[model samples]
Target: MRILFSGTPAYGHLLPLLPLERAARKAGHTTAFLTHASLGDLVAPAPVLPAGASLEETLDEFHRTTGTNAAEDMSPATAGEFFGGIRVDLGADAALAAAHDFGPDLVVAETADFLGPLAAAHLGVPWASHGVGIALEAPLAEAMWATAAARATARGLALARPFASVDPWPDCLQRDDWKPSRDRITVRPEAHESESGSGSGAGWEAPAFPGREHLPRVLVTLGTIVDDPEALTEIVTSLAGREVNVVVALPPSSADGALPVAGAGVHVTGFVPMRLLLQGMDAVVCSGGAGTVLSVLGAGLPLVIWPLGLDKPLNAERTAALGAAEVVGGAGEAGEAVVRVLEEPSYRAAARKAAADIGAMPRAEDVLPLLTARLG
Candidate 1:
């Protein structure tokens, strides 16, 4: 079976499917990763998202108009609709073109693509949604789903996808949980098999790091943007020249902007293959960006989060309250908190254990078979 996976950025979005790809390939299925060209490095040989892109521009427009960050609003209705615009549809043509070239049996994406649902309908193929439900994205129409019994009996029947905000958020975010879906895969194996949950490091085998093994490494990154760099930088500076080896990822947009450091151990890089680098690192001090947090959590690398904007803070709160991480006020306390985490073996142990759990959870690749069967 051949499957085409579409996502925005390859790092966070594509990763959930990595273990899946490995599984699918091992099972003799062919799979390909499709994403925008600019964001392709994370997934090599990625198909470009057509030229004259507008998502970034539209977001800039949204930011200028709203003066509030996207992550600030947890609700999709209030996420303000920038996500549901035509600007991101710039990639549809390329995605469709790639689909035609690859002639895959299924289309899998995180939530939905920038291109609205029309493209999927146009392709005459089945599409599957995956990812941690973000603020209950544009609600699902009740008329969209097919009866489970009817759909089960008739394999080709289309299921009604639920609205993202069908219910509310979890306890802290909401008063109740969502009306569960029959096909939904929310319990990520990556998050579950961790030492924190039951499946600690089930399928994961840690890769070895030779030279930098001794130092207690702390990966410093606010992900793509520092939402509030002024505040986020404080958290980073706090870790400077301390007990941890601070590897700060300088924003490519920063042109190496000066990040004041006090200690000699603070090393800043334009970029670091953190997923690979984390193999040797002890913990991560991040801005709680969705990508960074999920990646760190999936790796079972416990965290020290200084949420700057958007979903960072919320993700930080949820993961921390659950014992997977620590949420700090700002860069002001980031340094001290990191030291405490490192000096105390419990933090490291918890993170390592969490890593074990994430390893055991069902991964995105696991859905390809079902996706394939539906598309076929």
Candidate 2:
């Protein structure tokens, strides 16, 4: 079967879909990824059909759709508009073109990628949805459907939900209100740690810090899109002066001298493979992005989350409610929070339980049969 995959330009959406894409390819099915033009290089070796939206354009569309300029103010209303805008402005025309040119047997879209469903509706073909974290609520889903309805009408098609929905969130971690109407196949969360190509690396030397192996190690990340370099610098500086060994992973464009105090205890770098870093770390401090939170939980590492905006605050709240993490209001509190997570054994135990729950979930390969069956 020829499969076409679609997602937003961000790594948070694209990375979760890779394990299944690889599984399809290994099973001798041809696959291609359709996303924003900015992420085209990241999908190399696998044929990339550009959606013709740049990262800035996508961000602008998001703000326009959501009716908010600040990421911190994201709400259900914004989510609905975001999905609607994505389908109408970002990926619809490009997806339609890919459907005609690629001739895919099925369309597998990232849950956030509305264009996949629109194009599938246009072509009268079967399509599937993959969820990175939690499922959408009724209001958000309805808002997306509203946009999709208009698109379908314009294309002379009927809007319909996906034939299958792939979710990576474990049952325990899922939102209480999220119950799927479609066939919900749960997959384990796997972290993709590289900037380009198939990110399968697990082997990496721990960041060089002298005699620091004895001290507890804390990993800090703000993700790629969040641009709070000052906050990141403060967090790293606050921790480096403490008893713990600190590793700060910054974005590619982060300034070389971002951190104020650099010593043997703190190591700063641009994009270390997550699987490799998690192997040696004792605790994590992050911006509460679902991808990072899940990765930390999957590794059984207690985390301290600084919720900046968007879905992050909710992710932080849920994880903290589950006892796996402590959410802080700002970066200043992150240093002390990390200390608490390290000293408290209960947090570690909770993390282990979450990891066990994730372990009990299905792998990406387990979904291939269901996907193929749906195609038939």
**Predicted model with the maximum TM-score:** 2
Residue 325 CA displacement from its true place in model 1, Å: 2.2
In the range 35-148, model 1's lDDT, one tens digit per residue, is 655554444333343322433564566567766454355354333244433323344456556667777655555543433132344456556665532443224221112122
lDDT tens per residue, model 2, 28-121: 8999888776665555556788774765676676777555663455455565566666536656777789777888888998876777777778
lDDT of 2 at 34: 81
**Number of backbone collisions per candidate:** 32, 0
C-alpha TM-score for every candidate:
0.71, 0.92
Q: After superposition, which runs of candidate 1 have C-alpha atoms over 4 Å from their true positions?
A: 9-11, 18-34, 49-55, 61-75, 78-80, 88-102, 112-116, 132-180, 186-215, 227-233, 252-254, 257-263, 344-346, 363-367, 370-376
Looking at model 2, report the run of 10 residues with the lowest lDDT sum.
195-204
